[model samples]
Target: MSLLPNTMRAVAATGSVPLDDERALADVDLPLPELRPRDVLVEVAAVSVNPVDVKTRMRRPADAPRIVLGYDAAGTVVGVGSEVTLFAPGDEVYHAGVITRQGTNAEFHAVDERLVGRKPANLSMAEAAAMPLTTITAWESLFDRFRLDASSGGTLLAVAAAGGVGSILTQLAATLTGVSVIGTASRPETRDWVRGMGAAHVVDHHGDLAAAVREIAPDGIDRVFTPSTAGRLPLYADVLRPFGEIVAIDEDPDMDARVLKSKSIAWLWESMFTRGVFETPDMIRQHELLDEASAMFEDGRLRSTLAREIAGIDAAGLREAHALVASGRSIGKVVLVR
Candidate 1:
């Protein structure tokens, strides 16, 4: 018998607002989500705020349903859909769910089994919650979108080194491949953090990105990865070697393909939700990647990028997290726990 209640409390967007304020997110009662085939009902133990959460809440229409805006979560499976085989009741898991579905801000969330992975045994729920969204973004950008081989032995310039995705990407590039990582961080603390994350060199993004990267790579970067690529695509084009790859995972509506024409740079975009949103045949790749990440964490090869932990899983805590993320100054990730 399931212990789930008919209703659960969720930190939800009451209305769209350009600024993060106390009223931005509120505690509301929502009916427990009904499961679809291959879905698992998770008893959410922890959730981490991402830039996507802040952006989605800020742009949501006021007339839309009260939106729950979390993407990354870790919890125990309380129930599973009929076709679910990867997990069962009582299995601990973590995932970054598709944006098309209800989010993980609620006390309970239903996620596709193919998008979920077993939680790393060595990390707590809060730590595991911090990894899903950022890790998936970084991993897919390097290995999938960029198609970087393990022994590529090239240089990579990662922009915004202290942010959620950049931190993990820097570490992954440094440890998992022969890539010489140059991470961009403007502030002193972020620069130090980037160095600690295994960047061979830390450059200030507020300065000339191309000049700074050239100082390190000299010839030019072999690859570039960034989460905030809007308006900065040309910087990558200027610094990247001819035929080098640039992978961006954020919304780049104004990005022009002409910028990379001269360099013959291959520009690619990686959205972590693409497979789940399209229900692609390779949707289970996310599961495989997270599972590999879990093993890496357990083996002490990778560390969770959880920087701060908020005490409660409520509206006030979520609002605080949103403000931190919106400020664009958070070191790693801000998590809320029950």
Candidate 2:
């Protein structure tokens, strides 16, 4: 293994401040992360900002230690823990690190081998960084939570299909399954982007969502994949078929799932962190799925959803990325590359 540095440059959230505040994120020097038995140390080449990062920043306690906030990353492995068997000193990899650990918005990050995958040969580090978290969320939602397969045929309504998770979910549904995808997009650019991701149809989600979806899928949706579920349950209940399933990635504490009971519809939540956070028996499934997805990416079956890229891994760039994501108007993913 190469001689690792004792300290590295990183950007951490100093406090729960608005994006406009200069103190929101700051550059600092931190000691290298200690590796556990299954950990692999990666020299982070690129890191992508997700909604979780923004939420975490906003909710950060003022008195707490500065928190490095990131999830999706693509990089080269420089060192491995004693028991790491999947990767070595020179593997190019990508992963969505667990929330419990220090994040990937740094010069180097240590992650579990089970949560990492060899980076796709066809993609740039920034492109690959755009995928891990969203890809895992979408993959688990479709195959794990909903249990949809290549043979399952039906109309799937993908809410906010222009967003990160929605973009990948639309592609996976269109490419890997027999389901016909009807993606929701509020803007012309987003609608076009969703169509490029292989959605069979695109509808505006701005107003009368159920009516717009009904125009494309009159019979009712067989499945629904949503990033946000707040105040949308009634709309879902109106559009979903009997016994249909809705898999969501976002949290909605006020969500009344009772509305779906009348239609016998199932509501499920997909948190990609579940396996890693709980140290589940099948945590390694993330690695397997990412490897499978890598092949798909190399073969042109799957594509990266990177829409914007910032040049450096610094506080300024991350704050800009955070602002873009928080605006809730950005399409696809925003990444910062070193």
Candidate 3:
């Protein structure tokens, strides 16, 4: 087999957004890695678009030369750093790239062994690409935030349950715990999408979430996770039982926590990248969790969340994917094969 070549092309934002800013994530030159110890050089095969890309592109520093703009990907490792212990050359892997680093929107990406995991055996690279970001975000939010026991019984309420994160969150929680999942979605198609992901019950977010949730059980839910951008707290607070915990990945400056007084709620903001950012002792936990999740996928307990698989890796496909996520109605995920 031919060894992978150095140097690659990638999509990068050279200016600010509103993408109309003339240089928002166009094609750019990227350097290849020099084979750092304990690192793996993966030949990128596919990537997924998440809300973070859109947000980063919208707020990227204008003066930077050009910022690579993707996080989730699946690829074959062409080279492994000398000290690497887990993956070997030729192993296929999927992971969410570190935030401060150049992304996998290129032909190759050098990843820390701690952030990547073996891709599921049944999934193609495109299918595998759709999972990492949503799965990483959802897994950390519920498992890390609540410390949920794998065998515990509880009711999980997922707000905005048709989006990428919600889709995986519902399935993972449902499969890992005895918890019955109740997911909220407003549209008929979204309702079906959430149901297909293993949600035991569905409520419309358009109605009073508390009322809609109460209709299912007079007793409120045990845990809530929302990936919503705005007006999320009150909705979660309304349906959460006494001392029920809630977590969100988004920060709305206007959001007030005072409303959480009732239920003696535990509300937290979850960022999957926090461990990596702080170099916390548990940064390797992401690697372990993704491995476990992949095993579940292999076991047929969890399904891939990819909804749309676009062909070819390029700026136009990425832009279209980003727009779909920004529209807030996308169910599952979108993957672009390189």
Candidate 4:
């Protein structure tokens, strides 16, 4: 009764190595994943590499089984579990798969239905694949974590605005809301890319972030969103207004919250995997936000941030993508087409 294949090729991490080392990535044959009660089996058409894939692989145990490494993916639904109701066979969809499970680099991937959304009709599979992880991170950061009102006008400083998540965050903040977004980039090409994403102001984070931002907005920034918060905690404290909100997706244990003590700034972490990882009561929120993003993309309010495209979906392609991301110079997202 099922048309699904028994095995497929997947780009997996063979062992820990330098980011650009091709020997660390391999194209391996794997058995198809079993579907959970709320799962959908997706025949992957395209997938994008995120920094998480690179970071996770770097710290992976040497003797651990080869692990597939991808999160943002677009594909067609070929099968569904018993409890799946949101999608049917043949439906085109996209999702940022959960962190705990095997990922989306394989030919076929099994993902929870609640974390999947209909693909934007206007975008290609590769373009669609570039969105999920960054879109979800940006959406959740703006609405859920910071809880900023769309109608309220304030300055927002986005650090590393040329990167995957920051690019989308800049676009979302500038287009969907009244926020004045200031993006930080260290390179000319990336600065242009950030400005092209609709950032009102682009400044160099390698220089004085606070001074450059203050030049544009005499008043201090009301919110700050960044992927890294390691050594920049004190900078955030200086740039943010009193009682402002600061949200980051990366984990930095060295960051001391007391740095913002005088300003009473609110610090929060936005992990897109929280709902899927914990199976919380509001797990369906990812579905809701993703659907909204699809609609926005269809209506032309939002555009795909896919900047680089690779030809293959094999080990070599995976290594190339990981190397690009590690360079920290990618303007937007790097997607590998099947």
Question: Using Cα atoms with residue i matched to residue i, what is each candidate's TM-score against the true structure?
Answer: 0.96, 0.98, 0.94, 0.97
Better TM-score candidate (1, 4): 4
Residues 1-338, candidate 2: write the lDDT tens digits: 44878999999896677777878899999999999999999999999999999988788777778888899899999999999999998899999989999999999999999999999999999999999999999999999998989998989999889999999999999898999999989888998999999999988888888888888878888999988788888999999999999998888899888899988998888999999999999999999999999999999999999999999999999989998999999999999999
Estimate, for each residue in 1-338, the C-alpha lDDT of model 1 and write its tens digit: 26679999998785676444555788899999999999999999999999988778767776667788889999999999999999989999999999999999999999999999999999999999999989989988888887776777888888898999998998888878888888899999999999989999999889887787887878888888887788988788888889988887777788787989998998788889899999999999999999999999999889999999998889888888888998999999999999
Model 1 misplaced stretches (Cα beyond 4 Å): 18-23
- Superposed by TM-score, candidate 4 places the C-alpha of residue 253 at a distance from the truth, in angstroms, of 2.7
Q: How close to the true structure is residue 132 of candidate 1, measured as C-alpha lDDT? A: 97
- The CA lDDT of each predicted structure is 0.89, 0.93, 0.83, 0.90
TM-score (C-alpha) between model 4 and the true structure? 0.97
Q: In model 2, which regions exceed 4 Å deviation?
A: none
lDDT agreement of model 1 with the native:
0.89
Candidate 3: segments with Cα more than 4 A from true spot: 1-3, 20-22
Tens digit per residue, CA lDDT, model 3, 1-338: 14555568888765455654446657766778666676788889999998888888767567766778788999998888889898888899998978877788988888788888899998899989999878989888877887876777878888888888999999988877788889999999999999999999999888777888898878878888877737778767776788988788887889888888967999878988787667688878889989999999999999898899888778777777877888888888989997
Each prediction's total of clashing residue pairs, residues at least 3 apart in sequence or on different chains, is 0, 0, 2, 0
Ordering by lDDT: 2, 4, 1, 3
Instruction: Give the candidates in order of TM-score, highest first.
Output: 2, 4, 1, 3
Which residue pairs in candidate 2 have backbone atoms (N, alpha carbon, C) closer than 3 angstroms, thus clashing?
none
**Superposed Cα deviation of residue 108, candidate 4 (Å):** 0.2
What are the RMSDs of all candidates, in order?
Answer: 1.4, 1.0, 1.9, 1.2
Candidate 4 on 1-338: residue-level lDDT in tens? Answer: 16777899997896677655665888889999999999999999999999999889988877778788789899999999999999999999999989999999999999999999999999999999999999999999998887766686888899899899998898889877899999999888989999999999999998988899889877688999988788999989888989999999898878788999999999998999999999999998898889999999999988999999998888888888888998887889999999
